[model samples]
Target: MFESIKYLQKGNQKRAYQAISELDIMKHLAAYNPILCGTLPIGIDIACSDLDIIMEVDEFERFEEQVRELYGNQQNFKVKKLHIRENPVIKANFWFSGFEFELFGQALPVKEQNAYLHMVIEDAVMKRHPSIKKEVIELKEKGWKTEPAFCKVLQLEEGDPYKELINYGKNTGFI
Candidate 1:
């Protein structure tokens, strides 16, 4: 499976069967998230358990509920509790143990950073498309390194890069 993913990354169609098979699994899983957009983010190497989606929301009350529904509590898939990083908000992580997939995260408030991550999340969920892929690809193409990637791709003046990047990916459109 990993080899097939690598081949697809190289734009090879012969081995695309592997990537497509994985994508099929993902597409089935999509029925659960109902909020995620397009075949997760590709072109990057990730173990099945590597964090696949880290996003921000306006409220955390329903986060755990949503996570459990999307990932289930089986040994192969489970969501970690929420934690804080660099500020006074909660973030969540999930581990898709079966397929070596791990994509989970949440963002909250930050210092002097006023990003509308909550809105982005809502928009993406409502729209039902992974709208941020092109933007991420765009940022990478623009030589946007580190934190500047979000600012450049989202066309935002300033805000939390982590939240912005994740939110953009969750949304249906870049800007």
Candidate 2:
């Protein structure tokens, strides 16, 4: 899955730069691919953009410990274990140098790192439907709460955006 997708570097200039910088820090945290995902990676991120990263870790305990050692003591840092729809992951959210950062750790076997894969497929969608980017940006400005809902509201794709994108990725041999 990691081999099929490449890191994207085409988003909000500042956010993209921060993503790149954070990737450097994340590299020492995970032996597997440390991926940059979400709005910032696809260029529709706005001024209030927050960075999202996905790391595949061999040892969740060790990895989490390393992450804690790296940023747990930093000002404004907050960490939590999250389980969305039965998927287990760890999230670290904080403000570093005034930029919002959200890092997620995906334990081995990696289940379906949705946020990570979502951004990958979103990249493909953005490339195929350039106008959709405009719609997404507009919805974001209007405070749309989630990407799948936003895509449905904007008619960006048929069926569930998440499922569609995941299927698209699999069919295209990209995930």
Q: Write the per-residue lDDT of candidate 1 for residues 1-175, one digit (tens) a residue.
A: 1211233444533233353354443344342231221122233222221323333444555665655565565345555555445444433343332334443334432212223343244344334535654554465555554235435644755676666665555564533
What's model 1's lDDT at 133? 49
Candidate 2: tens digits of C-alpha lDDT, residues 36-82: 66676567777787767677755667767877788787667887787
Inter-residue clash pairs, candidate 2 = 11-43
lDDT to native, each model: 0.40, 0.65
Query: How far is 69's C-alpha from truth in model 1 (Å)?
Result: 2.3
- For candidate 2, the lDDT comes to 0.65
- TM-score for all predictions? 0.33, 0.76
Q: Count the backbone clashes (under 3 Å) in each candidate.
A: 13, 1
